[model samples]
Target: MKQPNKEIRVLATVTDYTRFFGLPAPAHPLLTLIDLSLCRHLPRVLTPVVQQLYTVSLKRDLKGLMHYGHQSYDFSEGLLVFVGPGQVFAVSESLDTSNVSGWMLVFHPDLLLKYPLGKKIASYGFFSYELHESLHLSAKEESVLDSLLLSMKGEYEQPIDAFSQDVLISQLEVLLNYANRFYHRQFLTRRTAEHDLLSRFETLLAAYFTQDEGPSLPTVQFFADALHVSPAYLSDMLRTLTGQNTQQHIHQRLIEKAKQLLLTTNLSINETAFRLGFEYPQYFTRLFKSKTGVTPAAFRVSAN
Candidate 1:
């Protein structure tokens, strides 16, 4: 029997994007910013979905829904969506191609290493949010972002110097901070939607830790799939409401379970570990020590 050759999907690198749109290669291979106004849309040429480097797109005059995973959402209201590397994205026909405006900032993770932004970026939560969880901006807010985009464009066009990278990085940070603020405001102001999300989030978290039916702990995607939301959306919403993301929320619940076990049982560390879905007792011990600064046995002894 002859085996068929698998087709390799085209992944867009920085250079590929430049060539695709008739723009120059980026000064830094790891990151680039493109002014939407300078480019023309060729919707027919684009793939239904593409795997590429991370892209942060801020757009105006966009209509129709943006699909992230299984969800469909409106982008007509100046929305912001963060697509991580390798995530699939489907581009629809622009409702008014002539009116397309805004900036697209694309960066590889390598661009942020040895910097504080790299370390703290994961803490921001929005990167993990789903497409429908996109931030909707007001006209005034859009103006503020446009101003920052203009400043960034200035940096990109200038000569490369000792200060160029630093300047651009600072601008990127500023933009992200403003986004953080806007997201917080969105969480606070959109009470009906936010509250509904918050309620659903609590229910989902409770179901996971309840341990009533499952033999093992749920993977992040398990809950995400159940909620019809992305893991990032769940994490971001929890962070907004409870000062914790999904992973942290899971850890907290695990700790609570461990506390109850220590107080009520004569089970050994291994026994408790197995009961809590840990495949290895040592793995369980390490997590317990990391969270509580005490090993399971030590905690049991202290409690006794």
Candidate 2:
């Protein structure tokens, strides 16, 4: 018989994950920490998949691209990456598990269901789809994360007690919080590259405004795609250095163009709004007033 297609596998429960990787069952029903070296073979996961569990992994010697929504991270550096529920990625055919050296901590969404981490978990921006870049950790930083992992591992091995869940949850939350802080540090430390991105962003916005055609309003995703960064990452980088996210930057540029048109041209309020690519004149009026503290008409009159 011809070989069947390598289908997408949904690793929903803690057991599902270990079984896929040929490991023994986990200590808990909802969580597991797997040593990659223990895997005798790798699963064929050439297509994208959104797992039901959250995985935070630090591994080296990966032989294939990790796809996040069609984009791939080379993983030449920054071995740490977080994948939350509904985020898509796939291990390619070239994936190397023979010499894999790292630990993966996975937990079902239900693990956090009753704890405060459950509510706070969704708020983590790094876990969002748009922020798919892996975090590069310094030696000290790696040690900090590893220590927390060890704590989780210790609690995981112990007999079930009331404190087991509580201790594990606390350690996991701290781990996530540290990762967040390190991501912020990564954003600031790479000032030169980020500055180039900023320049490109400004140039892109300028070109968009100057062009006489394409009347649709500019969106955050539009600029994000042009810059080749995730929407959340782009916003975080911008906010860190410039104090405003992508939407704010777009709005600021829009107001500048509106001011220029109101003073430099003879277009009516409606025409000016349309020229600036606003679908509705009322929205233009509202946004203009919010930014300028006066309506378009009032601004034009006050200018003269």
Candidate 3:
């Protein structure tokens, strides 16, 4: 008997993605803006797909979960989600494609080539955020983003010319900038949640050092996993609220622990370093000096 070959399809281009969505070919080879409302029908559910293009989508009035990063998000309101290349995502089986509204902007990485935005794109951390951490846009924010999407659509719909790519790219940059601004605004406006998360992170970090088991040094991923948030989301939230990212926070906590061991314990420098999770005493000395402007021995001498 012939066995069926089961392999997940990887959509490697905008055309491949559009074909899967039952849409016409894109106006440009490298970019496309899809208006979901125009699609008269969609699959009841979509299988998980790994795509090789960046996707930014604003979904509204959709009923079901969108899974990404081992989590699922219900798209019951105006929500913005960004999926970078090579990420796997799927629509829930209960998805109601009818009454779907909003737009999907997908672009190939090659489209960004030779542009400054290409190099700077990685700094937009929201792209790596988890599904549940999607940006819930206010009505005003939705309108602002919708207008930008429409502008991009209009620019690209015109016949391709020398100015078309540049115009579209400029609009895309503006869209990203606005998203960045709105993410910062979200962090500021959600004060109660932000404070709660910050408290939880601090408690987790403290407990990690106090615990006797596990790795000697804690990683940013440790706190991120403890908080049920993506590393990028955790770092972005901390950066927005505290002017420090996750690794910086971890280092600050580590240094605090090191200082305590150095001053309060009767351990030698090597012992102190080992207790603080450093394999190399010289590395610990280097870091301690860099952070405190004094070597561990010098610090202990001053403290004594």
Q: Which number leads on TM-score?
A: 3
Per-candidate TM equals 0.78, 0.87, 0.93
Question: Residue 88 in model 1: shift from native, Å?
Answer: 1.9
Query: Candidate 1 on 172-217: residue-level lDDT in tens?
Result: 8999999899988888788788788778766876776767332475
What is the overall TM-score of model 2 with all chains considered together?
Answer: 0.87
Off by over 4 Å in 1: 1-9, 22-32, 40-43, 48-51, 64-74, 93-96, 108-120, 212-214, 258-269, 285-304
Q: Between the candidate structures 2 and 3, which one is better when assessed by TM-score?
A: 3
Question: Going through the candidates in order, what is the number of backbone clashes in each?
Answer: 1, 0, 0
RMSD of 2: 3.2
Q: Per-residue lDDT tens digits of candidate 3, residues 1-304? A: 2211233569999999999877879999999999988763765435578899999999888876666645677888878988898888776666677888899999999999988999999999988888778897999999999999988988989999988888998999999999999999999999999989999998998887885432477788878988999899999999999999999998888889889888888989888888878788899899889999999999999999
Q: Write the per-residue lDDT of candidate 2 for residues 1-304, one digit (tens) a residue.
A: 2222346667778888777666879999999998766763756546455588899988866555565665555653447878877666666555556666778998999999889999998666677535346687899999998889988899899998988888899999999999889988988898898899999999999989886653689999999889987787788888888999999999999999899999999999999999989889999999999998999999999999
Instruction: Output the TM-score of candidate 1.
Output: 0.78
Q: What is the lDDT of residue 9 in candidate 2?
A: 65
**Better candidate number, 1 or 3, judged by lDDT:** 3
